[model samples]
Target: MQISFEEFVTARGPALLRFAYLLCGDRYLAEDVLQEVLARAYRRWSRIGGAPEPYLRKAVLNQYLSWWRRKSSSEALVATVPDRVQAYRTADELAARDEIWTLLATLPRPQRAVLVLRYYLDLSDSEIAELLGYAVPTVRVYAFRALGRLRAALSGRAPTTEARSG
Candidate 1:
């Protein structure tokens, strides 16, 4: 069966935006990428076949990766500590999450993407590899390297040379 583009977006847009945000770690960039992907998808909406979600998601990933490639060197890093606000989570939990996000922002795009895809999205390595157009081994390698970096950072140690290489 087929669905209108508007109906699909109404149902899936928020989740797609969240996925893009996790992939890129920037809200504005994520929105831009999603908008661009949706616009292109709309142009050929009629032609899209069964389960457009996967195709649209992959498009967002590809767009973010390509944009990262083009702008990686020129991107600026800014560190700011957000004001503490009382919420459901404890202060320590919030601080830890902030620290982890900081570390995640430091990772290379592909490594960050792998980590987000594996953990946040809870996709298996094979599924991640297929989505990323990478071999399963490569996906594993990225996850390993990313996790190693996060572990080392959390433990206040430098990553090993092997982890630093790729």
Candidate 2:
């Protein structure tokens, strides 16, 4: 059975927002992009062919990428120190996460997306390929290259090779 918009949003909205935040690395922009995609999905609710979640996700990804492309030329780097949090996480965990987040931001958009999809979303190569409109091999390549970059970043080395576009 097809899911209603309200039901779908109620169940998946938080997860979608988290995904968006991971994608954009900005909570406010993530919310805005998710809202924009949700509005568009609502407008086309009747025509959307299968389960709406996938469509909504694709919409979110497309919207984020569109915004990134538009703003990339003018993007500037600003160093902001994260505030200390009184939470369950140890200082090491927080630092590692922060470091990874910073490294992720330095990656190219596609590589960052690939890493997010594979690690954060726990999707397989085939699934990511389908979601990102890439061939399976291309998806693997992206993942491989992204992981290499991340490893290099963590190890304080520059990426050894440039990522090949598939």
Candidate 3:
């Protein structure tokens, strides 16, 4: 049975917001993405043919990618402490998170989306491929490339184009 938008939002809003935050890496943008997706979902609630969660998630991902693409060329640099940081923790972890996020933001949208869907959402490669309209092998390649960059960055090496060539 089709549930009302209110019910759907009440049940899934928090989870969706968390997913958005993971994808966007900013709480305010995450909230915006959720709101934007919910607004679209609201308009189509009656005509929606499937479970709305998938539709909502796909919308969030697409919305984030669109925003990223439009702003990427002019994106600003910012420095902030990670939320997970503790007073007792050394600066290394915090610095690592900053570097990671910086690198993550630099990633092509598809790579970021694949990594978020696969790792953040814990979806399988095939599932992520279907969700993102990629072939299974393509999904694996994106994951491989994204992880390679992250690994290289953490090791204090500049990410190389060698991964893209192979």
Candidate 4:
């Protein structure tokens, strides 16, 4: 059965916001993107086919990429520190996570998107390729290169200029 736009948003909005935040690496920007996508989805609600979640998610990703393209040159990289530390986690774990996020922020948008889709979202390479309009091999390459840079950074070595350019 088809659900109304309000109902869908009520149920899925938080998750969508989280996904967008992960993608854009900025909570405010994530909320903006999600709001725009949801507004568009509401206008086309009746025309949207089955599995609206996937459609909405794809829309968020596309919107994020479009926004990045427009403001990339003006964007500043910042380390996103949690406002409150969880009592259960060790300091080292939090530090590592922060370091990884900082490194992730430095990656090119497409490479970062591939890594996020593959690892954070746990989507298969083919699924990510389709979502990003890339070939499977291209998706794999992005993941490989992204991971290589992360590994190099974590190991206290700098990635070569060639790797950075790609």
Candidate 5:
């Protein structure tokens, strides 16, 4: 199944953006990665053939992770945050979600990526493994360990597994 680049972007743009945003903590970085991925995907769309999602996802994740690796967090840097940010749901939900993200950021980078892909993006172990180029069992282990850390972090808070299920 051959798809024109425009058609592919029109179809998968939103989902890819959402995935990108969830993968990277910042909207700016997410959008940047999305653009970079799409540009590369467009160049290789013919070779990608049908089912470009996995390829696009892998490319996006790889690009994002690479950027994270090259960054010097404490080194001199200048970037402006938006003056007006879009509001997340309600105040409480927003606060809870922010807390969860903060806890997530505390985990090791690989653990955090695995958990975000597994739970927030709702990718299965196999899917995450494919995207991350890891073994299925490795994905499962990272996700499990990440979940354990999150549980420990939020045990006293309002985000127990029971609440998550309900």
Candidate 6:
């Protein structure tokens, strides 16, 4: 059975916004991008009125990638600090996290997007590829390389036992 757009938005809005936040790492920009994607979805409602979940997610991902391409760098996206961060006993963890984020900013946009989607959002490779218009193996490769760089970036301060990715 089909649902109304209002109902669809009500169900998907928060999740979509969270995905945006994960990708852009900016709450404000995430909100803005979410609004923009929803507007586009609304405009193409008839064409994408069914199975809108993946459709909307793909739009959001494409919008983010497009915006990143136009921006010429991910520094503005990954270089900024999260609003609230944990205070560490040695301050080394915080410093390392900061440095990792900085190195993340230096990565190419697609790799950063892959890391954000795979680890940060905990999305499956096929789901990421579907959303980002990449091949499944490509997602795997990008995520693998991103994690390798991240491990190197925070080498000394690596989690003792393996904690969740932020």
lDDT of 1 by residue, 10-127 (tens): 9999999999988877777789889999999999998988799989988998998898677545556465455656678997998898888789888988999888888888989999
Predicted candidate 3 versus true structure: per-residue lDDT over 1-166, tens digit per residue: 7788898899999999999988887777788778988888888889876598888899998888787667544545365554665787678877776778788876777888899998888999998988888899998988888888888877879878854432
Models sorted by TM-score, best on top: 4, 1, 2, 3, 5, 6
Residue 58's lDDT in candidate 2: 79
Tens digits of per-residue lDDT for model 4 on 1-166? 8988888889999999988888888888889889989989988999997689999989999998898778545656564566888999998998897788788888888898888888778999999999999999999888888888988898999986646766
> How good is model 2 by TM-score?
0.85
Score every model by TM-score. 0.89, 0.85, 0.81, 0.89, 0.76, 0.70
Candidate 5 residue 10 C-alpha distance from true site, Å: 2.0
Worst 10 residues of 3 by lDDT: 72-81
Q: Count the backbone clashes (under 3 Å) in each candidate.
A: 0, 0, 0, 0, 0, 0
Q: Give candidate 2 regions above 4 Å deviation.
A: 71-84, 162-166
- Model 3 residue runs over 4 Å out of place are 71-95, 164-166
Regions of candidate 4 where Cα sits further than 4 Å from its true position: 72-81
Give the range where candidate 5 is weakest over 10 consecutive residues by summed lDDT: 157-166
Q: Model 4: which residue pairs collide?
A: none
Task: Please identify model 5 stretches exceeding 4 Å from their true place.
Answer: 72-88, 156-166
lDDT of 1 at 15: 97
lDDT of 5 by residue, 1-166 (tens): 5878898789998888887887776677789889988988877788997888877877878887776788644444233444765675677876797788677666666776787787777888888888788999877777777777678677765444532320
Report, for every candidate in turn, its global Cα lDDT versus the true structure.
Answer: 0.87, 0.82, 0.82, 0.86, 0.75, 0.75
Q: Measured by TM-score, how close is model 5 to the native structure?
A: 0.76
Could you tell me which 10 consecutive residues in candidate 2 have the lowest summed lDDT? 71-80
* Top model number, lDDT: 1
Looking at candidate 4, the ten consecutive residues that score lowest on lDDT are 71-80
